[model samples]
Structures are given as C-alpha cells and as structure tokens.
Target: MTAARLISVNVGQPRDVELNGEIKQTAIFKDPVPGRVKVVDHHVDGDRQADQVNHAGVHKAVYAYAREDLDFWAAELGREIEDGFVGENLTITGYDVSHAVVGERWRVGGVEFEVAQPRIPCWKLGVRAGDKSMTRRFELALRPGAYLRVVAEGEVGAGDTVEVLSRPEHGFTVADASRIFHRDRAEAARLLAVDELAPPLKQWARKRLGLELEEEGG
Candidate 1:
C-alpha cells in the first residue's frame, strides 16, 4: 500500500459563539497553518480545546480526518468542505482513518503517534457546520475520524510522510470503537479486547457490557 501523507496541518484557539440561543465556547473552527508546527505531548502548539472534560488530552492529542472522507462529505453536503473544517488537527491522505485499529502506531516526519480512538461526533460539529442535522448525518455516514496519542513529540508539516509502524492484534478498528460509542452493544467484546484504548472508552465499553459496576465494586 502507498504511504499516507499529511495534507494539511490545522490548529485553532477556543472561542465563544452563539448556538441555539446559548453562548457556547468551542474550538471547532480551525484553519490550516503554514509551515512546520510543533507537535507537543498533549496537543499541537497553538491549538486549544474548550471542553477539557471531553477533549484535548494525552490520549487524544491529535485528531486526523481523511481527505477522501472530506470529499465524500463535500459531495453529500453540496459544498466544498475545506481542510480543518471538521476541527481536525491533521488532514491526511492515503489512509482509511476510520478503519485504523486502536494501538496502531504511525511515524510521520519526526513524530510518532498511536491510534487512540474514533472521534465521537458532538453537537459542536453541527453548530460549526450551520446545520443541526449534520451530527446525525455524520453518525449515519459512519466516517468518523481518528484521534491519535502522541508517542514521540516532534515537528510535523503538510506533505510529511506517514508510515504505519505497527498494528494491534485485537482487530478492533476505529469504526468498531465508533459503533460501540454510538450504543451498538454488539461491538462490546471487540472494544474491550483493545488494550490500548483510552480509559474513558474502556469504561464506556465495560458499562455497555455490564461489567463496569461489577468490576468497580470488586
């Protein structure tokens, strides 16, 4: 298979905006950055996450969306969706990010990242796109992007080569994680099998499988 490559490096700061008569703070609006940017252990430099409770952590240091997926959405939405429009830190090409397995390691430029989980579509996605139905559409499409944990922090830029260094044996793909996240109980076993999944995701899978409470009390 051809090597995946970074098509764009995007970043954004948190800002407040009005959504459905409520003032909400979000970092969903991102723009592509020029030149190389520092990839920190926790996040990309100049990037911010407004909802720390749900985003921007060591397990989700960088979010990546495939250019092909963007193209599909562009055709479906009847408008050109630019890179970073979906709040991704990296717009990538030549990889089926939605199908990437948890624990898969990717070396890009001088940095290394591990696939952590699939990005769960939130209301902010709809709010940013100016369509309340966008979140539902995104869910139905099942093209949710991937979030990566920084394994080795360094600098990266657009056009950087991305090579997969390893893949987990558990066979739990990001799409499987996304399905479990959306309450598809059938994927619980596969979700639980992935040891590299973030803690919150593991807890969620356990809860869905009726194991969390049992395990916690023990």
Candidate 2:
C-alpha cells in the first residue's frame, strides 16, 4: 500500500485586511469565502486590491516547485519556502494528492474529506507568485491541487496525517478530470457521474454532459 506523506501545512491571515493594527483570523480549510464558505480569493503580493476568483469552492488547487520565483515586494510577505504553498487551508505532499479524483475519500486525523473538484487557476495566484505568468505555470502543471469537502465535520490543524479511505470506480484522477472537463466535455460527463464533484463542478459537468441527474424519488 502506498502511504501518503504529510509534507507541510500552512495557515495565514490576509495582510491587507487588518483591524486596529491587528491581523485577522488565519485562513482555514472551512473558512467562509466572503460570499461562499469554500471559495477563497487569492492575492500574489499581499495586495487586497488585486484579488480574483479562479479556483471555485471545494476545489483543490496545487502549486509547483519553482526556484526562480521571487517576491515583488519582499518587505510585506511572510516566511515562504521554495516548494511550499500558502493559499490552501491545508497542504499535502505525498499520496498523489493532486491526482486524487473526485468522489475519492481521504481522512486527515479524525476529520474525513473527499476530493470535490480540480482547481482552476485564478489571478490571485499570479499576484502571489509576483508574476502573472505563474498562474499559467500552475495551470499547466494540471496538478494545481485539490479541495476536500468535509465529511466528518471536524477541525484540522497542521501536522495531521491524511489517509486514503476510498477511490472512485472510474479511476478518473484529478489530472484526467482537468483535461476532460475543458478539452473533452463528453469524457467529463462520464467522470462527473462517478467523481464526487463540488457544486460548481457538478453544474459544469451536467451542462457539458447534457445528462441531468434525476433526483431520487422520495
């Protein structure tokens, strides 16, 4: 059995959104996304003015390792490692976290979360990277990362171990879902049926597949 490794976990408060000279709450996995709980707005240079929505709620987003990356304004930023990412409420390294398909389930500590959707890179990441092109880099990787829908309803902290509890029957990994959803909608249709997609993802899939899921009879 392949074991998923817990690489690093990070949580931080928005730099610009300060009150009385005090930092707000550190962002968490289930934190409310302004209008939505699962959705999060990202900024590159710690600038609140340059934020955008690329990754939808409950979507897992991944950032790759790049050495040439440098901060545009280093004075205002916090400690960042070469291969580490800061936006995600939770960070993971091993266990092919990015390749997890929708509908697949995993457990972290006592909390259970399921892969909801493949993340779509937004402008906020570009700001974070100090280069708009970095957004494309993340998108090109296709392993942008993943979002987990809480199943057990529990609080998760850094250093928690994640365990794979179930994998989808179709075997449609996150990478596959990203390509199929954009390049080939028909194939995506098949995946949505089996994948545990988030609301936005499910909506996208239903429209692309032209297969409306009938509600179960009461």
Candidate 3:
C-alpha cells in the first residue's frame, strides 16, 4: 500500500453564509488548511437534509489526510481490514473514494466509517476548490470522494496517520461508485442501501437511484 503525500491543507468561510445566524466571514482556525487536516465551522444548506444540524455536512471540520500515510499503519491499526478509517473527516484527493463498495471499512484513530458512497459535489467544495469546475472535476472523477459517519467519535487533529485497514470490495470501490452513482442511476440506488453513508449522501443515493436521474458526462 503506497502512502499519499500530504499536499496542502486549507479552510475558509462560506464567503456567502452566516454562522449561527451571525454575519461572520472568518473561522477561528488559521491556516484553515492544515497540513493533514482542516477543521472548520461551515454550513451545508444545499445538501439533501440541510435543515438538520448533523446533516449540515460542514461542521466538525474536514480533515484531508494524505492517502500515502496509509502505508505505515496497516499493521498496527488492529481492526478488520474492512474496518479502517482514521478520523480523516474527508478521505480523498484528486483521487476516487466513492466506489469503495459495501462492507469495506476505514478505521482511523479508533474512528470508523465504511466506504459508503461518494459525496455529491456541493457549493461548499466549489468555494473551496476556487474553480466552478472543481465540483465538476470531482464529479468527472466519479469517485467524488469518501463520506464517513463517525463510528467511534474521537478528537482527531492534523499530522495524524490515517490507516486504510481493508482493501475495497471486489469489483467495487469508491472510484467505481463515483462513475456509476452520477452516470448510472441503477448503481446509485445500490449504494444508497449501504448503512455507513452519511445522511446527506444517503439522501442523494436514494434520490438519484430512485429517480434514476440522467447525467451528461462531462
């Protein structure tokens, strides 16, 4: 297993939304993008269940750990190979994570979330990406990224070495789901059934799979 090098960490305000109804544009954390993690208090009103706080999808910040770090902990992170997910709030890169099929798990710092599904490209990332196409690029990548539901919630910080305890299921992975979820409605429905996905992703999976929506591949 090759480790992904930590590229850059960044964080920013909604640049559009208000915090707790207060009109604040900046976050408490500087260097918003941590070398390995990014903690923020943002908003996700555009997601499926935007009204719910947990469904906000932008709280608790996002930790963008490098995939390269996985190589070191495969042995020590004693958990089911499929049960690996360090506290990396978001596991991705210019890479794919949506296709990580059902039953596969990622354990990090005692935190675990199965490879549930891909994140729908939302306005939040669009702002973060700085390019309107950033979301488009994520969608095009198909493996938009990995969504994790906190299994054993614990305080995680940057510089943490997240571990990928298990390889993806056969013929299914985060990458595969990305392509299928957006392009093929049938497959999207399938992922929606997985229990590990966050609420927002679950809603997306159900809607896309239920409606069998058609998407024009970019």
Q: Number of the top candidate by lDDT? A: 1
* Per-residue C-alpha lDDT of model 2 across residues 84-152, encoded as one tens digit per residue: 442654545445656776678877655577777666665546555555675666656565466666566
Order the candidates by lDDT, highest first — what do you get? 1, 2, 3
Off by over 4 Å in 2: 15-86, 209-218
Model 3 local distance difference test score: 0.41
RMSD of model 2, in Å? Answer: 10.0
Write model 3 residue lDDT over 9-128, tens digit each, in one string: 333232334434555332212132333332223321111232234323432223333343332234433422111123233433322344455445555443444454445554443343
Query: TM-score of every model?
Result: 0.94, 0.62, 0.52
**Cα-based lDDT for every prediction:** 0.88, 0.50, 0.41
lDDT string, candidate 1, 1-218, tens digits:
77799999999999998887999999999999998899985799899999988988988899999999999989988999999988999999999998998899999888999999888888999988888899988887888888999999999999999899999787788888887777586777776677898887888777778885755554
Ranking by TM-score: 1, 2, 3
Candidate 3 lDDT at 157 equals: 37
**Candidate 3: worst 10 consecutive residues by lDDT?**
38-47
Candidate number achieving the greatest TM-score relative to the actual structure: 1
